[model samples]
Target: MVLNERYNYKLSYSTRNSLIMIDTILKNAGKLLVRLSAGAMMLTHGIPKISRLFGEGPVRFHDPFGLGPEISLALAIIAEVICTALIMVGFKTRLATIPLILTMLTAAFYAHADDPFGTKEKPLLFIVVFIAIAIMGPGKYSVDGLKKKKRSLF
Candidate 1:
């Protein structure tokens, strides 16, 4: 009976080698999804605002928090453009999420505070995604992952 159990264990171990391949595929897919979502969201919102800043549309902004329109626009551009690019490229993904999360929080607090929960749902969703990315990392396909590997070789 013991010999039979040992043989079965060996068989299972050999078959389990495929698990690594599955894990690799899943990790890559997840990385792609995260990059696309975060990157696209940032670009869609940031590009227009940036264009407005530089273009002839309107440089003036209405600050919801009563600080100043210029201040608000500057902060929004930084979080949307700089952080989004970093996140998309998987460079310092975890750290990049800090600004993204804060940006979403500010949007929710200042812009969506008086709105209904339905109106605030988008920012809330972004907050959750940013938090999840911060915790889970950018996965194996990211620059951060590559850096870790290179560092470990020493």
Candidate 2:
């Protein structure tokens, strides 16, 4: 009767709301996943370089910019480690992405320039992800979003 119809309507409405919430969560999660995975992976490469930079030995590294090994390693760490961390936390995301994008460009064009396409593929993928993030921006589930919310409250 009328009671059953009301119950069905309420259930459908609740279900619709649930679906909307899940969609939102998934959307944000996608951004988070990209940030985390890219950052973590870059860290694997950066961390060892960091150790190498500080390790006791002649800094033997590719001097793509003619900047010595130390400088090159420093730049790589800044991009791969620091900027990646910033991107992961969604703090100054766009600015952070700049360094990462640059690093990938360097890797693809210079470091792996003489190598085959397969050697350059990894950096290319990072470049695409960084570019996508730069375009889309950090989602609502981010530190940037929190800052925005706070600003709006003022």
Per TM-score, the best of the predicted structures is 2
Poorly placed runs, candidate 1 (over 4 Å): 1-11, 56-58, 62-67
Give the Å error, residue 133, model 2: 0.9
1-154 in candidate 2: lDDT tens per residue? 1226646534466677887899988988998888888888888988888888999989988888888989998999988888988888999998899988988899999988899999999999999999999997888778997899899999
Q: Could you report the Cα RMSD, in angstroms, for every candidate shown? A: 3.9, 5.0
C-alpha positional error of residue 97 in candidate 1 after TM-score superposition, expressed in Å: 0.6
Give all TM-scores, in the order shown.
Answer: 0.82, 0.84
